[model samples]
Target: MELPYFITWSKQKAPTTLELSKNSPHAFHIVEGSTYRPHLKKIVDLSSMSYQASFGLRNKMITEAIKKQMSLFSIALPKHTFDLKKEVSLRLIEKAKRYSPQTGKLSKDYKCFYTLSGSEGIENALKMARQLTGKNIILARKKSYHGATMGALSVTGDWRNDEHLLPRQWTVRIPGPEEDPKGEGIERIILKHGSNKIAAFCLETITGGNGVYIPHPLYYKKIQSLANKYKIKIIMDEVVCAVYRTGPFFGIDHYPFLKPDFIVCAKAISGGFFPIGCVLVCNKLSKRYDDKILSCGLTHYAHPLGLSAIKATLDLTEQRSFQKHADEILMILTEFARDLSFRGFKVRHIGHLMAIEIQDKLTIESLIENGIYASIIRENLILAPHLNTPIRLLKSSLKTLNKLLSK
Candidate 1:
């Protein structure tokens, strides 16, 4: 009999094979005595990714993170609280109150105007800006991914979705300086647009998918200062980079001197246990107008279940200083990259993330075929290892990779 043309084909005679070990609660149907590890399922989830990445390997790491988050979250609420939306919002309301000063801004010192569950949050950000600022054009960086929703897509610069017909408007996508121009070019770009016509300056703290190209250390400080100087509100998009992923509570913490009026965060806020996106606004922007309707709200905003997960995640990082740990992670990563380089795998772990630019596409395919996992980073392979990833396991994976490269 010929083999099946598709991916995997087990022994046809015993196609439904189930071993005695499989029946045991502690074990499952793993290929017996197989030297090479089996391929793990592809991770197509953007939700699982963020500053604090969710589990990738189909193993305990994912389970443990979820279980730990859920345990604290479930304990926080009463049983039978399945509808997590409203409760989640109420929790945010309380959290915001803690941050907002009692008497300050026109927008409630303690109240935020918007909370988007997904991409709609980005759409709402622009909508609110136009409603308040009365400016139609929104400023964004070149090659930005706001969201797929119509309004969010409007200000985006990613060309992958160019064919995707949405109510999109082509606007100014200023070229990021090839050598970190220190915000000189950005200020000139804003001046070019006639600041009165532009509503907001929205950008990522550390550019995502654009090769994790973290801006120069002074980038945000200069940008935030400029937005203030020109009366243009800054909308810092921290969707993938915020929430302790880079070892800081917020990726903005990396640039402590940089103060933005509004900051958008989503991924890792709920620790991959639930959905939660928040827009943290400082008093400066919040005080813009008197009783102006934001005209923005998501039906699932402040979802209780989602909020509970966020609360639990916040609590987990409460005691742990994410910033220090992130710096340490950076150091450890630098060491790993050096080792890979020693064995001849053109590697790069710069910016806030790590990407190994290998010799060719075949090497990537071969790596995935091995037990180790990663994704394409520009023309390289990305390794977004979890905070809990053990170095011993990484070393073991690298040894195998070295052998494969030599072969």
Candidate 2:
């Protein structure tokens, strides 16, 4: 079958390794086989830190799902479909409830719904907020990169957003932490837009693409206070930082006092093993829609295969060693950033994520030349390594970076 001309976000051609996948045998395939040896040796993927989950665990879960024939389904069935009632699905929901940062025990205050991608999670959250509040306006932080879908892109405040035409009703964008140090910008936007007209205030808990910008300690509290006062939904985008990416199971976990009405999570949720995202709604909001049908639905909602992956990912993350490694990686990156700053490389970092924004494209080319592939975002180098990246590998990357920058 011939593939259609689908639009892609990447400016460069697809790598040769992908082309090789076309010729490989599909049955009982082995990932560590000869086909991957050549490609794997040539590149170090520091692009998005999207491969934290071990292949061994991911494949095991997926293989189990296949054996049980749990991968069937076409449309979004009723919430109580037999497939959704399986132990795997129920476990995922329970996992979602128990993962709350505020209270460690099982929670009846929140409900979980799955989607095909992080963008769908964001879109569903917006839909729920608009439905609950009967408002159309959503306030996103400036320079935010939500997703590429029309609905998510409408709320994104980055340069790529210019390519699409979003609705005027959804055009409210607030200043980021740098400009609004105390988080007064949120309140100002709410006041100017009128609380009744705004449906939700959505933002990445720890900004990703623009820079790994961690908000002020009091920021979420201020935003939560204002949202509570006005009855607006607080939507936290944890797609990048959720599932133990930022020293906690969820980025919102760091702000225990502030319970967001909705949390959008994806990338690391299934350990990057499957395409699944979810919007977790707080108990109060979940209750409102208990008898009412949720207008949002996706074909892949609560897929058993994805649920299996989620179950395995959650179990893997619960191991004490994972959190310990997270702490170690955070310290290593922090020291790496400090060292680079002393050497005149402007580095911004939080946890395993870092952004180097010096006035030289040569620095990026130098890293690429050394077989390290970090993405260029806004003319800066963005490095987000897997949480379990070996300390030696990190040191080697830094050594190359240092040698190039000092030239």
Candidate 3:
């Protein structure tokens, strides 16, 4: 049967349909920290991949927080009018400050803006950079996935950008680590494009959808030097890497020497409860909008429910036990990847985010039969289970994956 709605990125209906359980309309029901189909097939879901269920499904704290806010008010427009928005914004600012490299105490030097998704955050960041520098060109790397929106897609370097190629007039594509291992391609692009015309150098701290490509520290060092020399603002896209996905509050936290002008994040911050994204701007740039009418606003900009979810999610991330469990999961994935490599599998992982290279085309049916449901990006299998997945369950899932890959 054909569905009424169109699915993004798919030419036809999915190969399998998950029947929602009788108790819940949602397809994948959560039980004891694991997701399962209605038919009782325990799905080892490594598919959420830090974007959907960073804190796992049906979290009591996040649910209660959102519910509490819902009881009061669901939507409040013109953020400044509401006290709850201010409170949550302050809390979020403080959390972002903890991960800042430049005098973490500079709370006055930063401002936060809320959006609907990571792409919205990227769009806002680009606007701010362009407005501040009075330039239109954006420097982005190839094989990068920033967002799906027009402005976001404009700076995006992946094949998804091919669909709307005309919006990329102001974007200059640079070589990724895979193309130019030495990382000199960025400087070349910057010089060719003329640094004065470029407003910002936007990129993921660690590449997400294209592939989990972690750059060498030297790559960042060079980038930092060039940005500083050319006066180009740095925008770090943390859509898939923020909220403890990479063993830190933010992926850029791993690179201490690099100070980004704007940090765009979403994903895990939602706690799988509300769709929200934000851009943290350095005071130097944000302050420009203090008196001037810097145009950018969303009707649902600071929805009370989304703020509640973010507050609860941040609270959970702050817990010592939560951090410890994430560390343990990282260790487990690291060891597992090491073993897989010994068997001729090429694996790249940072924290719990991993990508396994495969020669043969692996299908969703094969994965479901093996008692696992994971994401396949081209030829790479993306393994990103929730941070709070049960230890035994995680181990069992890895074992199942190994067996399936072996055959």
Which candidate has the top score in lDDT? Answer: 3
**Which runs in model 3 stand beyond 4 Å of their true positions?**
13-17, 22-40, 98-108
Local accuracy of candidate 1 as per-residue lDDT tens digits, 7-88? 2223455353221222111111224334485422322221223334532223343345556546655333222344444444
Which tens-of-lDDT digit does each residue in 10-46 have in candidate 3?
6665634544332211125323324463235455677
TM-score of each: 0.70, 0.83, 0.91
Best by TM-score: 3
Q: Which 10 consecutive residues of model 3 have the lowest summed lDDT?
A: 22-31
* CA error at residue 384 for candidate 2, angstroms: 1.7
Model 2 per-residue lDDT tens digits across residues 228-337? 79988888898887776666667766766666788888877775667888788888888888798778887667766666667666766677886787678788878878
Q: How large is the C-alpha RMSD of every model relative to the true structure?
A: 8.2, 5.2, 3.8
How good is model 2 by TM-score?
0.83
Name the lDDT of candidate 1: 0.56
Which 10 consecutive positions of candidate 2 have the poorest summed lDDT? 21-30
Clashes of each: 11, 1, 0
